[model samples]
Target: MMLFGHGDGGGGPSPAMIESLRIMQKNVPGLPDVVADTPERFFKHAASRYSGLPRWVGELYFELHRGTYTSQAMVKKGNRKAELSLRKADLLIGVFAQFRILHQNAA
Candidate 1:
């Protein structure tokens, strides 16, 4: 799986890169099949061919962005606080909705 494009900066495969792939498609001797395909299709084909591929059952920590785990402390804190706030808001909304329904029924 040769990912040919601008890494991280995101300018995706240039016309020249695409043209090069098109030119080299099935032309290179001793090389495996060289066909441009979506990641989904590639994975599907791989799964079908290699059924014994190891399955990952846990969180996939990005090895490339390991620094984020230590550097984004404030971001993680803010996200947790936001989540808690949303949960509290949901609880209050549900309580008020129930109360309103009871009051309406009583009236």
Candidate 2:
């Protein structure tokens, strides 16, 4: 039996990659079954889901690389960095809002 990717030399997805995508499509949480047939649809569903989340939650993924999820150490580091950035953004927003309130009261 010929595999889909063997000897194609076109840099297309390997068998393992296809298998992983199949697994992800079948199991990814919050992904609609209707959109699970292909990688592009799966990604579109994922992006739409992420976009609907709170700003800070989505901000946590602004610079995210999916590869981070492949390793425990990388996941930890990525989570920490995302948390730090979210905290910083929250603090800055609070400070700016306070400033605006103070300025309005003074005026």
Writing each residue's lDDT as its tens digit, candidate 2 over 1-107 gives 11344443577777796776677667578855422255667556767878775433335554555554465897698889999999998888789888774444544
TM-score of each: 0.50, 0.28
Using alpha carbons, what is the TM-score of model 2? 0.28
Lowest lDDT 10-residue stretch of candidate 2 = 1-10
Give stretches of model 2 more than 4 Å off.
1-71, 101-107
> Cα RMSD (Å) per model?
21.1, 16.6
In model 1, the runs with Cα more than 4 Å from the true position are: 57-107
Error of 1 at 27 (Å): 2.0
